[model samples]
Structures are given as structure tokens and as C-alpha cells.
Target: MTNERRVLVHPDADALVAAVSARFLTKLTDLLDEHHEANVVLTGGTLGEAVQKAVATSPMRSAIDWTRVHFWWGDERFVPKDDPDRNEVQAREALLQHLPTAEDHIHPFPASDEIEDIDAAAEAYAQELRDHADPALRLPVPRFDITFLGVGPDGHIASLFPEHGVTRDGQDLVVSDEDSPKPPPRRLSLTLPVINSSQRIWMVLAGTEKASALGLALAGASPEEVPVAGAEGRLRTVFFIDGDAASHVPADLIASQY
Candidate 1:
């Protein structure tokens, strides 16, 4: 069974950050208590980095067993590993640097500079996931415990842009995107099939410029029109939005309760 999409609106960016941080800690604690290991797929963007900062600043940060948490990227900028624009670099500055996780547990996509071939690098990442699968389990693929994603003002998520082939296919995972609307133009994104396999998924939006896209997604736009509409999770799917971002969503409906 799949969970219905739900939204949580906050008064401002600060409040949104707090809500995301609190929920993140709660989810991490609950997952840790219920299972010995947890897999987290993280997104990259201003809001995504803010959530990381909030986690780092939260008092309950220490409660998580970082060693048992496997971190993965939802999508990354096709740049050099050390580039300031790289998602991994920003993520490290915000939270990963403060966490006690072993360096090996942090899984970042290959750098465009080092790999030379973007498609090959993406294929390697897919292979890594396959290699990590539990031998005893006959599941089609390894599933993540949680996946944190952020939507673009254009409504794309995890590099799955509107009308893109990757957004329409039901592949387990994708190794390359040929026509990304976003800059850098190329990326590897988890397909809808893989994204929906997660136990939980959270979509966070913060800027006022994102309001229109948020409204469309909550109103059930087609994935080809707004890729964010494709977001789904087997257990839960949540939308975390600040006031500026939620302003366009109908007041009588979703955001009012929050």
C-alpha cells in the first residue's frame, strides 16, 4: 500500500527549518530503535542544506547512531568533488562534518572531473547499491529507509525534470539524464520506481519563488507537467514548506491545518 501525500506548512523559513529538524531527529530515533541499520538518501539545494544545518544544531543530534546510518545522494551537480558548488561539499559543511559517521559510510557520487564519463560514474553508483543488497532478501532491489528531496521552482525533483524520459519511465534507477533543464545538464537520479520503494519520503520547499510549483504539486498536477507530482512512498510522503512557499496552496485545504 502507498501512503497519501500530506503537507506541513510553517510560518517562515526558520519555522520550517525547525519543523524539519525536529521531525528528522524523531524519524531517525524511531528508525534506529526499530531497526539495526538505516539508509538515508539526501537531496541538495538551499532548503536541503538548511535541514542539514538544523540537524547539526539540534540538541538531539547525538541520539543517532551515525555508524549504522548509510548516507546517499538523491542527485548531484556534475562538478569536481572539491568544488564549492558540489552537493557533497555543501552537505559536509552543514551536517556531515559534525556527524560521527565513518568516512566510508558517506557515499557521494563520482566527481565529473575524476570519472571523465558521467554515464559510467552513474552506472558505478547503481552497481554499488546492488552490491550492498542483503543476500538473504529476495527483494528486487535495496530500499532506502528515508529519502529527503527538494523541488525546483520549475517543479523538478532529484533531476527528474518535467517531460523528461527519466521522469516517465519506471526503471529501478537511472544512470544518466540526457536533457536536464537545470544547469550542468547531466545527472543520475533514482527513478520513480526506486524512489517509491522507500519507507518514507520528504519534499521540502522554502523560497517564495517556489510557491506556484508547490501549489501545482499539491493540487495533483501530472508528472510530465510537474515532476514533483510523481513523488511517492510505500509508507509515507510528506511536504515540508515555509509560509512563503505554501502561500499559493489553497488555504481552505492543505496548508490551513498546518
Candidate 2:
């Protein structure tokens, strides 16, 4: 069964970063303790990098056996591996490289330089998911303990843009977007189904510019019109926003504690 969505508003961007970082550490430890292994799907953006950097400096970061954890990307720009625009590049500089995480355990999408094209790269990632799928998940993916997503002001999540029909239909675990409304044009992203398959989905957003998108998502907007609205987790779904982003969110939807 799917779970209802919840909203958590932080005082500001800085508070959002600290709160999320702390919550991440706690969730990681809990998942590791309960399952012995944890798979995390990470996002990329200024905020995403900020959270990673915060986790790197966190006092509780060392408590976990990083080797037991597997890190995955929710989506990636199809760029050269060494390109500064690549999410993995910023992520490594911010956190993953600092952890003792096993090299084989970090699953980044195939870079443009490493593969033929976006389609090939997308399939490569899909195969990687299949390779890591747990039998019990009953899906062609791993047991994603937590999937972190950064919502665009336009309400897109991952590379699933609302402008295109990218969020509409696909059983493929991963899909390639060759003409993204945003930069770089090409990208690879996990489908909404794959994202929703996770145990928990954390949608992180900030800034007053995101207020409309947040309000629409919570107002039951169609996925095709607001992709973020369609994203949910089997166990839990949460919208973690800052005061600025929550400007249009209803008072009742805002949880004082989560």
C-alpha cells in the first residue's frame, strides 16, 4: 500500500540543510541497523550538494559502516565523466569521496564519454538496477531505503519534466531525456515507478520561487502537469521545504514535527 504525503517546513535554507543532514544520519543508521545494508538514491542541485557537504562534516557520519551502504543517483546529466556539470563530480567532492563507501557500491549513471549515446547510457543504468535487484522487491530494482529528490521550481523531479510527457508512461526502470527543457539537453533518470518503489521518498525544495509548484503539487495537480505530484513512496512520502518554499502551503499540511 502507498502512504500519504507529509509536509515539513524548515525556518530557512540553512535550517533545511542542517535538519535534513541530521535526519539523514538518523535514517541511515536506523536502516543500517534494521537491514544490515542500505541503498540510497541521491539527487543533484545546489541544495543537494549542500546537504552532501553538511553530511560530510556531520559528527554522526562516522557511526555507520559505509561499506555496507550502496549509493545511487536518481538522475544524471549526460556529460563527460570529468565535467564539472556532472552530478557525480560535485557529489564526490562534497561527500562520497570522503566516506569509506565501497567503490563498487556507488552506482552512478553512465557518462556520455563512457557510452554510445543517451539511449545506451539509459539502458546501461537500467541493467545496473536489474543487476542489483533484490528478489523480494518484486521489481527490477534494488531495495531503495531512501530516495532524495530536489524539486524544480517548475515542479519537475529527477529528469521527469512536466513540459514533455516524460512523466506520463514507461515501464522501463530508467529513461533517457535527450532534449531536457533545462541545460545540457541530454540526461538519464529513474522512472516515477522506480522512484515510487522506494521505501521512502524525500522531496526537498527551497526558495520563494518554488512556492507555486509546492502549492500545486499539494493541491492534487496531475502528474503530467506537475510531475512532483505523481511521485510517492510505498512506505512514506515527504515534502521537505523551507519557509520561503512553503509560503503557499496550507497551514494544516505543515507538520511541526516529522
Candidate 3:
């Protein structure tokens, strides 16, 4: 793990989405070139959905074989599969449905109706990851080429909220949350350890509400106090933020274009 961190600030939310979408396409293309297939973990939020929409509308959308690209979500609301609030549902409506990806390649967490117990659903997803992992990859989770995340206003990543017991929990690759701080308390999420295993991580931020959290995490705040501080890619960690979100970050830490 190189553990390199880069902070990129865009002019605004729209430019941020465009830049991220372009990079997403290029990253997938590069990974597919080196391997038979590529794996990417998706996030859910306003910026996340915007990025997906950008991808769907990008001219380079067809550059890679969508069938060989496996999609997984970092976390999902424990709602019915068809619920508009479900991350999987939002992703499909935003982009996945337009792609040629096979049903088998889209790994969405089980919904409430699919499994009676949230813990059971989380375990099942972990098993699914183990089954898909190639022995040569030697990872608890699949060797993700890129993992996407959205930092919450409170500095949480995925469903691992700051100071939550789950943030320090290392036992499960996927954890179940029945009491999330946000509404729709139920959720299933890949733990910080599991997310950090990815080769590359992209944390996308858009609005000013996230600026304080982003600033704190990038400045060496304790992960236990700010869960977003805990997640870093094995090779490369990137913060793709719009100016509003990057406003609170130190001028020196920002890569360029203030």
C-alpha cells in the first residue's frame, strides 16, 4: 500500500461530477486493460447519484465492456429492493440500468424483504464476496480496483458513524446497522477495514455542509472520532471535492486549483 493521499478541488458540484465521471471511465479502462475484469464499489448520495448520471451520459460510457465490470455498493439502506431510498435502486435508475452489465455481476446487499435478519443479510454478502475472490487475489473482499465513498456531514463513511462501535469492529467484512444516526436506521455496510483494502479509493464531496468534516479528517483527526479518517486506499486515496467542500481544508493540503 503506497498510502498516497491527493485532494482535488473543482470549481463547483457540476465540474466535480464531470471530472470524477471522466476519471472513473479512465480508471475502469486502465484496470480492464491489465486484468480480465474489474471490480468497483459504489456509494450512495447526491454527489454519488450525480456521478452515476454523468457516467451514463458520458461519451466514453461504451469504452469498456460493462459485462466484465463487477459493481458493488459500499453500503445500502435496508429497505425493500425497489424502494427509491435503496442505494441499489438509485444506482440502477441513475446508471446501472443503462449499462450492459450482467445481473450476476451486480452485487447489491439484501433488502429487508429478502432476509428477515439484517445480520444474516450482512453475513450472506460477506460470503458472496469470499466466493467471488480469486485465491490469487488473497483478500477478504474482492480486489477492488476502485472504491467510491461519500463522507457524511458528520464525518461518517459508509454506515460507520464516528465513535460508533462498528467503526472499531474488525470481525466482519460487512456490518449490519440497526441504529444509524440518519433516518431509515437500518443499513448494511462494508467495514472500514474492508473498504481500505481496495487498491484505490475515491471520496467525493460536493456541498459546503461536508467541508468541516472533510477538513477535520484530512488534518489527522482520530478515526474513532471521524470514521472517514479511517478509510484510505491500499495504493491511492483521493478526495474529489468541489470548492465548497474543500473550503475548510488547509491551503497546503489541497493539490491545485483553489
Candidate 4:
């Protein structure tokens, strides 16, 4: 069964980031109060980076025990660790550096130096997930309290593009490609099954470029034709979008805030 989705429209980009950051802190604090630890899968993109920066600067930044929160990336550019385009690099500079966390808690994708190739990196990451996942959960990945994601203009989620074979390749936890439609062609991403296994999924969308894609996904488009349409959390899925991105959504599909 699929989880229900909720769309929230903010006034602008900054507002969207602030709202998400605050909500993320609240969610983490609550989860820690209940379980004493939490795992979050992060995304890397314009909005993703922005949200991290917001979290670093938020007044509530010191509220949670960052060391107990395990961080994982949903996808990463296949480049050296220090490359500007690398998701792990950007995330560290934007947010992780500011938090009080143990080095072992940061689970970045294998960099070019650590693997023979992108495909090898994917397999290594899959192995890491399997090794760390709680045996009791009976799931391939860890218990992701919240997995944050960003949608591309073409309706792609993570590295899964429209009609891509990887989107349907359930056997693999992660997939790699050296010829992506987007730049920095080579990349690695978690498969749909791994992403959907999360307890909650938060999709952050911004700008007019994402408007049509959001419209199509929310309009019951097929997951193969619009990969973002298949991204759903097991317990709940929430879309935090700016006004520009929410513009194309049908009136009946959006909440009153719009």
C-alpha cells in the first residue's frame, strides 16, 4: 500500500527553507525523545543545500543531540570527495560542519578514491546499508525516520529519471549511471524500494522550473513516465514547495494555504 501525500505551499524560497528546517528539528527532537536516536536520509540539490544552511543557522540548532543522528545521502555525484559538485561535500560545508556529531555518524557515499568505479561504489553503499540495518526491522536499509528529497524539473527523484530501468530494478539497493541527462553525468542513487522504506518522506520543491513536474506527479501520472510519482514514504509523505513550484498544481489538489 502507498502512503498518502500532503502538499504545503510556502510564500517563497526562503520561507520554504525556514519552514522545513524548523519542522525537521521538531521531528528529530521528537524521535530522539521516543527512541533516543534517529536516522535521516539526505538529498543534494539547490533546495536541499538551502535547507541545510537554514538548519545550521536556525535558533533551535542546539536543541538535539546531533551525534545520535545518523546521516545518509539519497544520491551523490560520482566525483572526488572534495569536488564542488559532490553532494557529501556540499552537505558537509552547508550543515554537518556546524553540528556536534561523531564522525562515524556521517554515512556519505563512497567517493571516487574509495572505489574502482561508480558501479563499485553503488555496491559498496548497498553493502553498508545491509550491514548496518537492524536485523529486527527485516528491511534492506536502516530505519530511516525521515528521508528528505528534492524533485528535478524533469520529474526525476534521486538519480532515477523518467522510464529509467533503475527505477524498476527492485533487486538492487542502489544504482549507478555514467550518462545521466543532467550534468556531472556519473552518479549513484538509492533505489525506489530503499527510498520508500522510510517512515516519512519530505520532498522539497522550489522555483517555476519544478511547477509542471509537480503538477504531473500529483495528477496521477505513472511512476515510469514520471519517476517522482513513485516516491512515497511508508508512513507519510509531505511536499514542502514554494509558490512558484506549486503554481501548476490543480486547485482541487492543493490545500487552502495556496
RMSD values for the candidates in order, in angstroms, are 2.3, 1.1, 1.6, 1.8
Q: TM-score of every model?
A: 0.91, 0.97, 0.96, 0.95
Task: For candidate 2, give the lDDT of residue 91.
Answer: 93
Residue 168, model 2: lDDT of: 45
lDDT by residue (tens digit), candidate 2, 55-139: 9999999897899999999999999999998889999999998999989999999998899678989999999999999888757
Model 1 C-alpha RMSD to native:
2.3
lDDT per residue (tens digit) for residues 111-227 in model 3:
999998999999999999998875654366788989999999999998888877645445578998899888799999998778888899999987899999998898888888888
Top TM-score hit: 2
Worst 10 residues of 2 by lDDT: 163-172
Superposed Cα deviation of residue 180, candidate 1 (Å): 2.4
Q: What would the per-residue lDDT of candidate 1 be over residues 1-258, giving only the tens digit for each residue?
A: 658677888888888888888888898899989988888999888889989999998889988888898888888777788988788899999999999998877888888887878888888777777766645333344558889999988898887887776454544564576557788777777777677677788998887889988888878899888988878887788888877887788865564442
Off by over 4 Å in 4: 136-138, 256-258
lDDT of 3 at 21: 95
Arrange candidates, best lDDT first.
2, 3, 4, 1
Name the candidate that leads on lDDT: 2
TM-score of 4: 0.95
